[model samples]
Target: MYLTAVASLRAGHADDVFLLKRPGWVRDTLKQLDEAKRLSGGELFVARWMSGVVRAQVPGLFGERAAAMQDLVWCLAHADKAPNLGWMREVYFHLAALHRQRGEDAAARRYQTLSGFASETRPATFTTPFSEAPVAGHTFSSRLIREVVPGAVYLLSGFEFTEYYFVVSADRRELIAIDAGTRADAARAAHEALRARVPSLPPLTTVLVTHAHWDHVGGQRYFRSLSPSPRFIGRGNYKDELAHDAMANPAGLQLFFGKEFQLADVLSYKPDVTVDRPTELIIRGTRFELLPTRGGETDDACR
Candidate 1:
């Protein structure tokens, strides 16, 4: 029964139709999950939690809002039994959004606080790029941009897998970008979105890479296409780091990055400028101090 329920859920996800257009799929999945929970003698906590989540999303499709609220509250009541703090955080975040949608500002704020608490309490080991679940507050198909330093620095998030930033030079005539994205298309889309948002954004003059990870450098080719091109800067050990990763199992890399990932793009990435030691660069009147560090993910990391 549990295996059947899992299969049902996967099929529901595979459907291309919007949830609202497929209420039968949602209802069927919920029924399967409930049966799985019962057959497991209530030992299937993950199934139960997933049922609650499915129920919560039903209001957005074809159900009563009150029913959705009840299921969300039930999920919170069972939060202590969650597989991980990350899952609990997701519940809180979802509840917050639901409350806000219903114009319950106070309840939304309370759940937002709880969500932040869950995030802070979550162990670092729970954080991984390979989670099948989507990141909270981030939609892979959308881009979110925020001005981190009023008019000077901005952050671009919600790329397929990573976030990058833009810093306007002191003269506001050039932009220094921090990191590319996971793919050339993603980078292009993000850049176009950023340009649309900040119509006056300057031309990219420099790109500072923090690491040589595939996700960070896969979009280098897009930046290189700019007229005159931005100067790409990265750690001098970039080649050696890529060489080391090349020895890793191909299946393992595909599992983490998805089958759509291209090894050749990552392998062909090369920065125009490399730094091995402490160095400082001044681009368009903005001073950037680069420091090397042994990052948790890779040795070729800079800040």
Candidate 2:
């Protein structure tokens, strides 16, 4: 029911005054989220966070600033309990915007700084091993490398916008990279950094991409240049998805990837192996089950 309301709200453009002004839609949506919270076993933090976001949005369109500020403040007080850095950052950014709307410059600046700090520290705090995870809202501005599963799996965070992972085979003879990252330079630097940090790590023999998104496959060319070029793997619909994105938003490519991003690089990336259905792959001794699934972000996704 909560998901249904969210979908409806999204379809109706929840921010539009027409939907917010509808007799009981917004109010009932909040009520449903409240019920969802009650039945969430104290684990669904997103429900509470969504409610706060809706309340924050109501003020500008409906002139309910006082009530919205109260809910936003409550969310701020409990921001530490947010499920991830992205959620925590949104709460801070919302508060900053609300304070700015109310003419509270100092308060707005404080939350803005907190939001930037959250963005800077996100890669490290969430990707590190569970036992060694950093405190919430910790501030740092450098890349981080951590062993997620001791000797078998490791994480390379903070090199680029997306996090990359390296997995070792059971016999420790082969290494596989999870994603290529956003740019060749960034990917090359991350790969070199990992090898430098773990000199005994095995040669990278395979590169598996979760999807055909620009950020995930941009570094394919670099990986292809290795001594024994690693075999690339991606979803069967990879090319179709890339073509769709290229036709739909060709102009926006450089906005996120910078002016230097080349569309030809992304369009030319091809996986040596493509999985359209459930497939089992054994790299050296480590086994991986590849499942292609559709998601809100992209239909050509593999897990």
Best by TM-score: 1
lDDT of 2 by residue, 1-303 (tens): 466357337524655657436636666665665566667653455665665666666536555556556656766676555544455665676677788888899988898787775431233323222221111111132367789999888888766556779999999999999978766766787899989988998999999999988888877778988999999999988977788657746446555554445566677889998899999999888999999999768999999
What's the C-alpha lDDT at position 111 in model 1? 86
Off by over 4 Å in 2: 1-141, 248-252
Cα TM-score per model: 0.54, 0.53
lDDT (10s digit) by residue, model 1, range 1-303: 455458446544836757565666666666676676677676555665555555655556455456546656766787655554456665776677778888999988888787775432333333222233222222342345779999899888666677878899989999888987666776787888889988999999899999888788877788888897999899988997889756767556556555555667777878889988999898778899999989688999999
lDDT of 1: 0.72
Worst 10 residues of 1 by lDDT: 128-137
TM-score of 2: 0.53
Question: Once superposed on the true structure, which residue ranges of model 1 sit more than 4 Å away at CA?
Answer: 1-142, 249-260
Q: Model 1 has how many clashing residue pairs?
A: 0
Model 2, position 17, has a per-residue lDDT of 51
